[model samples]
Target: MPSYLEFFAGGGMVRAGLGGRWKCQFANDFDPLKVQVYADNWGEKEILEDDIHKVEAEDLGRRADLAWASFPCQDLSTAGNGLGLGQANGGDRTRSGTFWAFIDLMKELKATGRLPRIVVLENVVGLLTINGGEEFKAVVAALDRLGMRAGAVVVDARHFVPQSRQRVFIIAVSKTAKIADALVRDEPHPTWHPDPLVRAVHKLSGKCREQWMWLNLGAAPELKKTLNKIVKSNPVGVDWHPPAETKRLVGMMSDENRKKLAEAKSSGKRVVGTLSLRMRPSNGRTIQRTEVCFRGLAGCLRTPKGGGSRPRVIVVKGASVRTRLLAPAEAAALMGLKSKYRLPDVYEHAFKVIGDGVAVPVVSFLRGKLLTPLLRSIKKSRAADDSKARRVARGSSERKRRGQLELRV
Candidate 1:
């Protein structure tokens, strides 16, 4: 079996997508809670729980066929309050410096000559434009220096799941490899030729485009599932806001949203879900403003911090309207975790783990459409080369045998 090494392997969501093709030989993460959830699900799977820098690359024993690093993206994410990568105004760089640690690990592996055949990195799309696109150029150029040519695509999770999460995936292969990606943009596949991905590629510097390959997974199927279908709506509810609290929430809505709420009530549609609440200025004072929607797709899951995460989701079916915290199972399903996936008991922990994970079907799509096929092609080419070598060796032996017979005559 082809083996893989995964970094920041939180919750093993990537593993879920890779399916039965790739065996996860080694995994590492720094978060204890995420490791706890991974252990609960994987059950005694060998995991290194120390910081990446502290772990010795030689300790891995065997080199992997593939190496993946999702890397930490909080520093690169736009959702955070700090400057992206927490860099001083074009001077002091802090949080995003964690990415350099991943670089160190890559270098260490190279020094040991155990670096994997294929390298894949995942991070927020912000990396594409952060620091005037300098960060992204550095990433691709770094791969080039390591003797790998890089290809990139920015994909949204909503296509594979019911959540609108967008992330960028960077794929690299050795420059000396004979089999390479098609690197063409005009393939007939549907989801493979996405607009954002095109934009991402176009934005690369001339040098970045030199080794670029277009990874087209083709048109993904139309998602038949909706947010309402996956939801494990609680019958035995928890954290249901009292009527007065509900009234306050309703009152805080913008006039436009309030009109929609009223329309829902008039239409006798009993289901309601509030997306989020934030402070807004109203008549010389700041008050909370709320937003609600009955849309099919859900807002992207956010990491838990204060009350910033898991806003109220209200369900109204008939005479009764119910409001409560979104169930953890529902959150897990949005991440494409079907079964054999375990959730932490605490709501905050559950949200944190799921929020940080890539959607399973999206990863699975890449495996079936892109990674597996590429690996197969490489194997086939290598086998053909070996056969040619054997034929040449046999021909030389025949010539030697004929010369010996002639000498005897």
Candidate 2:
């Protein structure tokens, strides 16, 4: 079975996606709450609930087939201040600087001849343009220094689930490994390679460019679930807003958003959508407004910090419009987690874990389309090379024996 080392394993969503086919050699995360949740579901056999910087190569058993890191994205997310992975501004103390520690671990693994054959880094799409795309170049350059040929693809969770979470997946293969031609293309595909990512690739240094690849995962699958399908009519861990409070929420909507709500109410049939309060500029002043999405998709789930960041659900059936804080169970459903998956009892803790995770189905899609196939080809190539070496060794021994017999004669 293929093995993996998971870094920043929030609730082990990556492991869940990898399923039973892949063996987890090691997993690490710093957050205590997330660690508890991960242990509750996956046990504590391979988990080390500590900082990634303090983790040593010895902590990881054998070299795994793959190393996956979904490092902290606060520094590179649009919701953040765009600090550019700490090399330029904050100097390794920033949240996203955790990526450097991951790189350091990779370096140690390489020095010990335990480097994995494949490495995958998952993060927000802002990594492509943060600090004028310098951070993205630095990441690719780091992989190149480790003797890895790297490529990146932008995958949106909306393709697999109702949430509109877009994440960039950087996939790197060891220079010594043989990659099948079918797994890559000489040029980027329009769907997976957005303009920002293409520009970021073009801006890479010559050495990094030479080592870069255009990974070909082909087209995204059609979305299976819609917003209405995943949301529960009666959700747990939260109560629906009272009629007066729901009216106040509607009163907070701007002209455009109120029109959306009005249209939904007039549809006669039931309409379900997502709502979030955002501050927008109006006549040189910023004002908070409740925006609603009537489409079949939900807004991207975010770690609820303050009141504004939390997303709410809006249901309209004829003239009855109700609003409520999106339930924790509903958020998990949006993330494509099964109903039986264990979550924290606290509402905020459960939402934080769900919001901060990679969508399960998206990881599963990549495993099916790219990871498994690529690993299989590499294993086949290595087996062939080993067989050839044994044959050569046997032939040499036979020739040596014949020479000894001639000498005796």
lDDT of 2 by residue, 1-409 (tens): 9999999999999999999999999999999999999999999998899999899999998889999999999999877998767772235657888898999999999999999989999999999999999889888888988999898899999998888999999999887788889999989898899999999999999878887889888877899778888777788888899999889888888998999988998889789998888888988999887889988898888888987788899999999999899888888888888888899998889988988899999899889888999899888899999999999999999999999999999
The true-versus-predicted C-alpha distance at residue 219 of model 1, in Å, is 0.4
- How much lDDT does candidate 1 score? 0.73
Local distance difference test scores for all models = 0.73, 0.90
Q: Superpose all Cα atoms of candidate 2 onto the true structure and report the RMSD in Å to 1 decimal.
A: 1.8
For residue 119, give model 1's deviation from the true position in Å: 1.3
How many clashing residue pairs appear in each of the predictions shown? 10, 0
lDDT of 1 by residue, 37-108 (tens): 777776547577888767777656587788888877776776654345432133455556555566667778
Error at 33, model 2, angstroms? 0.2
